[model samples]
Target: MSTTGLYQDQHLEINLPQAMVSVDEQRLILTRKEFELLAMLSANEGEILPRNVLLDRIWGYSEEIRTRTLDVHIRRLRKKLGLYGDSYIQTIFGVGYRFQRFREPRALISYQSPLFAATA
Candidate 1:
């Protein structure tokens, strides 16, 4: 459970009640299933959630059932997340998926000649 139904990190923010998601401060339009998937993964953070578990939690599917719903959703989510998708969502392979915490981009150091000369 997140505070005030909100899950937030350095690069992502999710409002559960509003069913809204934003990345790097930019809002993203997502489907209902997509939002739920992202919410669950992000909430768990670094914990790896197996396919069965995710299926059950998200779609009420049994472990024995074979389907590509999860995979499809994951792919869609990744594509929607852009560059941050792969960086944040990780595949366990033969297991499940996990949402990695977002990390702030490193600040770039300027090495302009004028600035360097002025400092010198």
Candidate 2:
């Protein structure tokens, strides 16, 4: 149960058990949704997590509900992730969001397979 995820050249770390995200060793104050979004994206780094998948996973399943909440949360997460945010979480344009690979940290590289793993 290794829990620390180091990304962005090791400037960012996501501690799963703590549900804590830190940038350059400074803890960020994220809403629960923000933290969950960050955790989900980080856990599945280097892949495009579809909008529907994110909505269901974060907000729980709800009859394909339409809302701008996901975008809002992503914006907040990016802002908190600081300068290299967009480089980390990328927009795939008309599809979904992809968590770009900052670097292959040893602890969690196993999940960084091809982007379409979930769909394929």
Candidate 3:
């Protein structure tokens, strides 16, 4: 199995495993650390992973690394995600962040095709 996560849309796609991020009409590029941070957060979507946890998981630092580093990285990630970033990822006060599983409202579906149908 692959250890990559993908955040995509009609115009853009981010490949976490390849450490490549592509925006619409733009080139895909990212550093290793940036990709790692994004992958870790994305892997634990909807969980407000604390700063220490993120540092430990991504940087392998045990509560000793500067917290600002994490903050900086998160800010960068948010910028990279663009408009959809706010919808997918959220910051919890005094804690950390949560990657929300993008849930498209059923009402928005105009067709009843099987591909769009939900199965339990």
Candidate 4:
């Protein structure tokens, strides 16, 4: 049996057995909910986790129920994480949230339609 469930990426590390999180080698003191929330998001990585799904998973809330609990927690988490949280955890407007390793630099890439491909 493995007591340690490690979730890590380029900048973050989560140790489930110890309920510990470290970002860029700095440890963060987090509440139980905050830790859980971060763990969930980190586990999913780049995937967009729906609000309903997060509520259900973290708080056992039904999809029919409406609340701002998730938002509040996210805000706190972002504050605690500082610039890292702001850059990683993203709001999908009316949809939900996602945790990405780093902000994508899509603006640097120019888009070319198929019709213009031959000319360029």
- Using lDDT as the yardstick, the better of models 1 and 4 is 1
User: Order of all candidates by lDDT, from best down to worst?
Assistant: 1, 4, 2, 3
> What tens digits encode model 4's per-residue C-alpha lDDT throughout 4-69?
567666667778778888887899899999988988887787889999999999999999999999
**Candidate 2 residue lDDT tens string, 39-62:** 888778877888888888888867
Q: Which whole-number lDDT from 0 to 100 does residue 38 have in model 2?
A: 82
Q: Which residue pairs in candidate 1 collide?
A: none
Which segments of model 1 are wrong by more than 4 Å?
Answer: 104-120
Candidate 3 structure quality by residue, lDDT tens digits, 1-120: 124567666655667666666666576455677778777777776678998888888878887656588888888777777766676668888888887765654676566899878897
Residue 56 lDDT in model 2? 89
Clashing pairs in 2: none
In the range 13-118, model 1's lDDT, one tens digit per residue, is: 8888888888888899999899899989977878999999999999999989999999999999998888888888899999999998777778999776874586
In terms of lDDT, the poorest run of 10 residues in model 2 is 1-10
lDDT of 1 at 90: 96
**In TM-score terms, which candidate is top?**
1
TM-score of each: 0.79, 0.74, 0.65, 0.75
RMSD of 1: 6.2
Weakest lDDT window of 10 consecutive positions for candidate 3: 1-10
Name the 10 consecutive residues with the lowest summed lDDT in model 1.
111-120
Error of 1 at 5 (Å): 3.0
lDDT of 1 at 51: 98
